[model samples]
Target: MFARSLPIISLLSIISLRSVSAVDYSETYVGCVSGTGTSGALASPNVNTISDCNYACADAGYTYAYFQYQSAGSYCSCKNVGPSASEITPAVSGNTNCGGAAAGVNALATDYYYNNCYNSPTAEDTTSQSTFDACFERCTTYTNAFVSPAGNVYSCVCSNTASTGTAQNCGVSGTYFAYAHTATSSPSIVERRKRRLSERLKREEQTRLNRFCPAGLEACVIPGLDDSFECIDTSSELESCGGCLYGSTGNSNASTGIDCSTLPGASFGGTTCSAGRCEISACKEGYNLVEGRCDWHV
Candidate 1:
């Protein structure tokens, strides 16, 4: 009895495993489904046909390929998982025009193209449907995503209903049908632009601030003038020897050099500014040199 039970248990386990796993029809056409692009799946729009859609998915290494048609337009997307039962909206047709692996397709006025095997297209959309399509699936924000072709990657552009030319056939990378489905939430594309703009503004403001005085130099008002100033090295200025001779109000963290030659009681050529302070080498007969200053003799 124990031996018989073990065999039955093993067989049941095998059946369950087979039943639970989904089929891998990679590159093959299984069937279609319903709804818009797969929820949160990497998707593309304007793929030419289901055939191209299949290659697009396979090339992108997704488990399944999803092609959709609605009042807006046709779209293609790759997903690792098949659509939910609610999204299994099919449009059965006996037409095999696009060279699908199946004899007929499930195309309808509004369609959510899908397959049982689960992978989408891997190859480029031979149709003008690509370009705005890739590095392929990075732009899955709102449905109005467009692209600017650069080196090897794409500059995905984000837009909404407010953007112009929703009906116009795309003319940037190639001629292609257009689709529009504005989303209420902003995606990476818009967020990235905002962050970059903020960074640029901060940089510009810093540049303007530093223009008044270079890093090591100080901006000093030219004494009797209102709107004029001069750049002075505060660490060793002779006139503004120890610090700025006169400064209106400004950065609490800047050096202000003083004028050593302007000290009273010091004769010409008797006093000199060195380092950042006034030094008295010799004083007039009426004054005595004390420490570094020219003091009056008592």
Candidate 2:
């Protein structure tokens, strides 16, 4: 009798272990549930339904699971432990009856939702859909719960009506511009013009920097003016004008070089740098520069 009882106890222990190992498919919840880091976790792509999520978790030997809502579908995440009682929202339940419901026609402006991925191409819609209304309508046609007009394009994304997904943790402020959802709102003309102008200015600056100059010379912008730049020969421009005027020190005397004012006895006038050296291009009326000095001629 004692030996038979020992076998029965062992069998009971085996049954208990099996029960503990079984995955609980019904313990789903919202939020980014996890331990300190990714310690007992598995992620599954294209998990559209709860069953898919649970199956993926079970296959990966995890006991708990959750979904990440996105345009493509719900991505599944499997974990070893269920969310804490504090982490679970029992009142709000999963959409067991997703029912593939089409978007309603009477959707309100606030109902038009979107996730902020970033201010890059992911944030803006660069498509031909010109207005937020058009983009939202496109979303409704395909059961997409969110429409975003960012990056100057229209984008429609799938969403889980069950829960609001985690907001993106964009590091920068203001760069993450808001998405367009207004029915009457079209793409921002002002924004488009600003972008075009910025690109044009960049190109123009590059062209100026590439202007032809003698060897050892480079192009630079003039000081105090937008659109004013020149190829500079630092070795010869007036010592003050040497190098790029944009940032070169304007000191007139540097022992090795001389500004227009410090040219021997010649008065400051038409003086220019030819390669990396200075030359008197012209003289004031009634004055001629001779032997590094200016003389008045009758």
Best by lDDT: 1
Can you give the lDDT of residue 226 in candidate 1?
64
- Superposition error at 233 for model 1 (Å): 1.7
Per-residue lDDT over 1-298 for candidate 1, one digit per residue giving the tens place of the 0 to 100 score: 0000011111111012211212112232323344445577656655656655554443333445666654355666666554332232223432112222211122111111221111111222222222322311332343443333223333334433223433321212321222233243324433443354344445444445447887766566565676666776666666776666676224322445555666767777776666667787877779887877778999
At residue 67, candidate 1 shows an lDDT of 66
Cα lDDT tens digits, model 2, 144-251, are: 233333344434443222223444332122222123333332134223423443444455445445655555665555556655546656666675345554542222
lDDT of 2 at 245: 42
TM-score of each: 0.28, 0.21
RMSD of 2: 23.3
lDDT of model 1 at position 71: 38
Return the lDDT, model 1, position 155: 38
